[model samples]
Target chain A: AQSVAQPEDQVNVAEGNPLTVKCTYSVSGNPYLFWYVQYPNRGLQFLLKYITGDNLVKGSYGFEAEFNKSQTSFHLKKPSALVSDSALYFCAVGAFGNEKLTFGTGTRLTIIP
Target chain B: NAGVTQTPKFRILKIGQSMTLQCTQDMNHNYMYWYRQDPGMGLKLIYYSVGAGITDKGEVPNGYNVSRSTTEDFPLRLELAAPSQTSVYFCASSYSLGGSGNTIYFGEGSWLTVV
Candidate 1:
């Protein structure tokens, strides 16, 4: 079974500063990793995904993540944080030949102004 | 394209009541999923269907059941409501390219309260 781990329950960062949300995964084979953001009373919105390619993957809203194979980590990062970016984030991992995606508990990001 | 549509945006059920959450997709995708999100918790999959008449249990399927009678509709049934079942439910669908890299689209979400 594929599983994902989000180490932080909540992260606080000042607006205009850099921010990071950590994520790690355990899978049998090559992993297909994804990040999603959810706002209040809304469904999740896909941010980015890492299939197989370059270690660094850029996503929506000036966000990006680095797929570190050795570390089994895919941490979401943004150079500058915005108040509007404060929301709940999730990390998910899936393996080849499986339609199931295992998700992490989640992390709440708060951008302090 | 309307993408994925789920009905009953909000519902309240008494204990022992039964209800079904309807979901439909207009994208012609072959895969659909049902998930529930609790307060401050990650979404937990209840059931998934890869195609018509094919469904499988997911991480949290004990209190829920699902059926896929057609390619576009997958309705989730809760036979008996419990207070613990109160949460926001989301319906999602995706197209599998015979691989693991397809993107999944989600609906706005249906809020349910079991009292």
Candidate 2:
């Protein structure tokens, strides 16, 4: 059984400051991690994914995530936050040969101006 | 490019009333999925299909049914609408399973409110 956990329900950061949303996973085999963002009344948009690659993965909207195998974590990061960056972030995990993805509870990010 | 399109962007249903949420993808992807999102809870896969005529239940399939009669369309049917069923429904598609090219594309979502 594969699962994902987002330890924070909400994260607040000041605009222009670096923002980090934490995510961790548990899987029996090598994991395929992903990050998605959802805006108000919209579906989730893919941010980035880490299947087998460098430890750091960059994604859309100036966002990036670090895939730390030892820590079993894939935390999303942005060098500078914007007020419009406020949205819901989700972390998902899937393994090879699995067609489905298991997602975390989701973390709401709010960028204060 | 209307990647993934879902009908009935917003809907209101009474208890025991049934409805079908329509989904279609122009990407010609082989895998399609249906998910429900609730407050604070991430997307939960309700059903998925590898191709036409093949469908499988996901983590949460209770009170919901789905069919994949065509490669481009995957419709989710709600048999008996309940207050618990009041949530936003999303339709997604992927080119492959888990890999570098297997990024899933999602629809704008269908907001269903069961009274």
Instruction: State which candidate has the highest TM-score.
Output: 2
lDDT, residue A94, model 2: 90
* Candidate 1 pairs with clashing backbones: none
Q: Clashes in each model (backbone N, CA, C under 3 Å)?
A: 0, 0
| Residue lDDT tens for model 1, A35-104 | 9999988888899999988999999999999999999999999999999999999998888888887778
What DockQ does candidate 1 have relative to the true complex?
0.53
DockQ, candidate no. 2:
0.59
Alpha-carbon error at B105 in model 1, in Å? 1.2
Across B1-115, the per-residue lDDT of candidate 2 in tens digits comes to: 8999999999999999999999999998999999999887888999999999999999899999999989999999999899999999999999987323378989999999999
**How accurate locally is residue A98 in candidate 2, as Cα lDDT from 0 to 100?**
89
- Candidate 2 chain A, poorest ten consecutive residues by summed lDDT: A94-103
Please tell me the TM-score of chain B in candidate 1 relative to the true structure's chain B: 0.96
What does candidate 2's lDDT look like per residue over A24-93, in tens digits?
9998889999998999999989999998879999999999999999999999999999999999999999
Error of 1 at A18 (Å): 0.6
